[model samples]
Target: MATVTTDPFVGRLVDGRYEVVSKIARGGMATVYLALDRRLDREVALKVMHPHLAEGSDGAEFVSRFRREARAAAGLTHAGVVAVYDQGIDGETSYLTMEYVPGTTLRHVLQDERALAVGRTLELLEEILDALAAAHRKGLVHRDVKPENVLIDSSGHVKVADFGLARAVTEAASTATSTILGTVAYLGPELITSGRCDARTDVYAVGVMAYEMLTGRLPYTGETPLQVAFQHVNSDVPPPSDVEPWLPAELDVLVCALAARTPDDRPVDAGAALTLVRQTRAALDPAVLDRRSVPASSGTAGAVGTAGTDRKSPDSGATAVLASVAAVGAATAGASRAAVDRQAGSPAPAQPDSTPTTVLTGIGPASTAHLVTTSAQGDGVQHTLAMSRGDLAVDGPDDGTPSPRSRRRRAGWWWFVVVLFLAGAAVGASWWFLSGPGAYTAVPGNLVGATQAEAETTLRAVDLRSTVKEAYDDSFPAGTVISTDPPAGGKVRKDGAVNLLVSLGVKMLDVPTGLVGTTADSATAALEAAGFEVGDPVEDYSDNMPAGDVLAVSVPEGSSQPHSTVVQLTVSQGPAPVTVPQVVGLEKEAALKALTDLGLDPSSTDDYSETVAAGLVISQTPENGSEGHRGDKVALVVSLGPPLVEIPNTYGRNVTEAEKMLKDAGFVVEVRHPQGISPLNIVYAQSPEGGAGKTAPKGSTVVVNVF
Candidate 1:
């Protein structure tokens, strides 16, 4: 592996949108980064494939796998699964944008704490299996299930991530390659033996994880990769109780069954596994199986007995030795000869001269010691061992040769080999048996567009069995087949099963009608019946609508709605009217208060009134009993006094001008001419009112003397 210098996407932009922020993690085939989605205004985790992994000869194959797996994962709508938002290639880099989970992986947790409590461990395991169950139902098998692929969020939500190595069980067989898949520690027996995998394989991995969680150790260990792989294919998993006796037997059985050497021997799928786990957890008492109560020796060293004697107990020292061997084998499987030479133990029969010396150290004379060394040569590498007990030396040939005391020491190794061989034979026989009899194949058809009966018929004609899996499809017709397993042209045994995905169709909803102008409660009932959820209704006064009537709805009537749509109603509070209070004879302050109490505004106009006292209400607009709206202005006419009068006499002036002058002087104009007096006609009819000074109302009519 080369050390990454500068970030791969220092200046590159993806789809003219996402800009890489920083490299977050790098795996064997891809690198993940924290990126900014310029369009969505949010942070996203971007996974970019390595150029070699993307464009090499294997690139096309890997890319296809990636697309299929990503699509399947994206289709899942579970809280425990990371959401994939977008996927595309920017130049040479193929990347996927996903929800940025803010937390560490289970690997990080293990690295930090080494192990967790039983409750916490079970909680995390349950979440992981839940995610797997969802994926399995979608026909997605996460080939790579490991601690690093399981992410734990800050809120303690465990999400399964990294479906890059996932395989769609319905796809073509041309996709399967001979290259090793998944972490060796979690790889299932069938997967290691024949490269065959399915939901059961995933169950096996989950079982391995569960075992590790409880024991803080893997069930299998060896000095080489082949050894570990062989163990998966042959060895039976020692019950977790062997390592953690406090773990319930029910849980141990589940884990052990999942790690069974044959797929048939394990649970049917993730669902079955989950059911078993739930049942086991429900039936067992955690307090009775508490780790603190178990003896220290019975906990971590349960598989190894006391006094260093090779006991034949079910949880025996041999099981522990085999597990340790498998672990070491897996770790050194891909290493070079020089690397293998550094491990403990002596050389096997295949190599002798290359074997290294082994030594044991102890604190006291009573302590035991064993020799461990590694041997390497051009042909292969081997493990050698020697045990010394105070001058009693024990050495054995690498090829299971009998030592001086071989009769006793050889029993365990011989038994282990027999178990390994029998397990391998059993798995092979099961596969052969299943392949010949119950195998069935069907061509991939447009399940989404076909009716359920049509899909069943199509599958039946091909001797394939059909199982309808209901799902939501925006594009496919409802009650039709969405897709089929053993894709078109793919071959399966004659009786093999074919799974069909059926569409539930687009969700339909009725439009809430006649909700407008209805009361809040009435509208709520109507909308609820129409498959719409009703929100709180708002009220407002309207001048046109009657009080307490429905004014309008949030969603207009006749609109199609889905279940749970929130509809808001606006109810009318009335025409803003107020009952006018009577203020006809009250004092000015009292009259104003009365008008205000009726939600009406009052203003006063003062005048000199002879009938009413000062500061008293004389009259009011809209008469005192008329109804008015709140905040409406009302004018009050307060009497100041009777009208004042001014008298004027103009007999000699022009008749028209005289009338105007009289009118301007606040006097009533009257013209009277006597025939006899011409010269003094202007003064002939003059009266004492000509110069009269009497108070009257302004602009009031007055009597005038004219000739």
Candidate 2:
């Protein structure tokens, strides 16, 4: 029977800004969706927390933690970390908008290939550790560190995601009996017992992941989640070389040190782990790094795109690369016996890396199991506990059948299990061939914003062709995609065509031209004719143009530009006004030179002055300090010698009359030799001898001799 699922938010608008396009993935904390940001005209991943996580004030703690995801991921802007764009609560829906990465989770890859090449595994894990290192340095710890939290883009670039469980190192501790919120497989023992967590906790989880990647299986597992937790609290992770003989000693040491049952035994944090990993990678022989553990031909799942609807070729530019790893479960009793043989001085004494336990955890204790969606393993999880030394036991009902350890000891029974698996696959193969890989696919979601060439490449990756049509779209840049026929997310045949409309940019219009020397009104008319808006006239000085005449246009003439672009006209305000400098008390030639330098016409006129000296400026017509244009005129006054005055013929006359005569002649007079005042007050001697031609300037001082 087919199961039908309906989503209320699938087509709903989120907070009036994000338009939910399709569901991407679901996890223990939230459901991820591919959404369109209407405001930014871009796509994003919108993660909406489950309603049960945050309902209202009662869920304040949960809500706060949910919101902290944004701050935590936002603070980490490294390329290996997914970016957060926005976060808010729209009614009861708390959501976060993040950079939409077109890729698959590492868990999915592990699902298809079972294990990966050692080089590829390290290449991917390095980025994950680097991102975690950045977060750890920022005082944050990613409580959940597993394959599901790692995203690999189509280009094989790795990005760490799901900071939903991230918290400040100070706030990482939680009650052991409470939620105990983390996947059991990666949880450190301290997190299970003491409810204490720090950067070291994340480092421990990373070590488990490394072991799984190298061996294609988790380190421990149980029928019940508690059994897994029990192992985490008691056991130590073994070296990967035990299962995959090709693994190197360095990797074995790294995995063991990272997954040590004692928290103090592991690296201090992801930073320490990353340094060790880099050193190990550098020192390892190239042949070992390049060695393939499991080939892709072993039940490889083709590339899966966003929402699991679209398919991509392995070599596609935007293809999804998954990393799927099975859970740690009980090893066959035969393998366990082999391990015991090594412990008896076969491989030397058990070092710190060797312990009776395997490094792995399941979900929290049964009390908190309802909150978890994943076990210690990823999707399609299986229990294959890879142990270094211990009993291969799992708890279940007390049936007549033997214990798991007893059954596993009979390695010959594996033939029956293999026959059963082959039979089931044979029956399912018919349905898959009819309706799965041989049928339809969801149109790629990345075509709406990609370049024409890129969109075509994506289409071809899915065994489809692209048909492009040009459009005059102003919203997107030229040569970029505008829209697609049938749109994204719609189902189509595997061999169908994807029609695309590419933008030709805005409609081209002739630029504002021929505005110089024209009137402002005419310039405006010309701009309107060119399909442009005329902005306010900009005034500037132009020696050749008159006021209100256009001097230039903002845009170049005759150039093609977008229609209705605002073009400003530069209008001439005749010529800039020149300020007349003060020329008062300056020499006549200097004053004339100053006026001429200012581009003003200088004129001179004669004048007699008592205070001003001759050949020097006295005052100007337009004042010494006034505003005038370059061609305006300024008048200067040239001084002539004071009018000549004849000396009075009163040498022998009365001194009073001589003084009066001197005064009337515009001269200052003074009496001499008149100490006691003579009876007639007559002049004793006249210095000029009553000369009529002797002259002196007006206001000149004259002396009269008196008896």
Off by over 4 Å in 2: 1-5, 164-177, 295-342, 345-707
Candidate 1 regions exceeding 4 Å error are 1-6, 168-177, 288-508, 514-556, 559-707
For candidate 1, lDDT tens digit of each residue in 241-345? 555443443454556656666676565666556554664556445553333212242333331121212212132121111112111101111111212222222
For each candidate in turn, the TM-score is 0.47, 0.44
- State the lDDT at 23 in candidate 1: 76
Tens-place lDDT per residue, model 2, 1-707, is 01113667788899999998888877766788888999999999898878876554446666776677567778776898888888999998988899998878888888777777777878877888889877875677788888888888989998888664445212322421255767899999998897778888998898888877776778888998899999898876665655554454456656676677776556566655665576567756676676655523452222111111222222212222111121111111222222222221112111121112112222223211101011232222111222221222334457757666666654433443355446545533643444333344557888987999999999999888889899887678998997665455443556888788999989888875667888999888878877788888788976578889988888898899787578888999986799999887888999999999888899999788888888878789898668888778899887875766787777678888888888888888777885666788897776544476787788887777787
lDDT of 1 at 580: 73
* Local error of candidate 1 at residue 531 (angstroms): 7.7
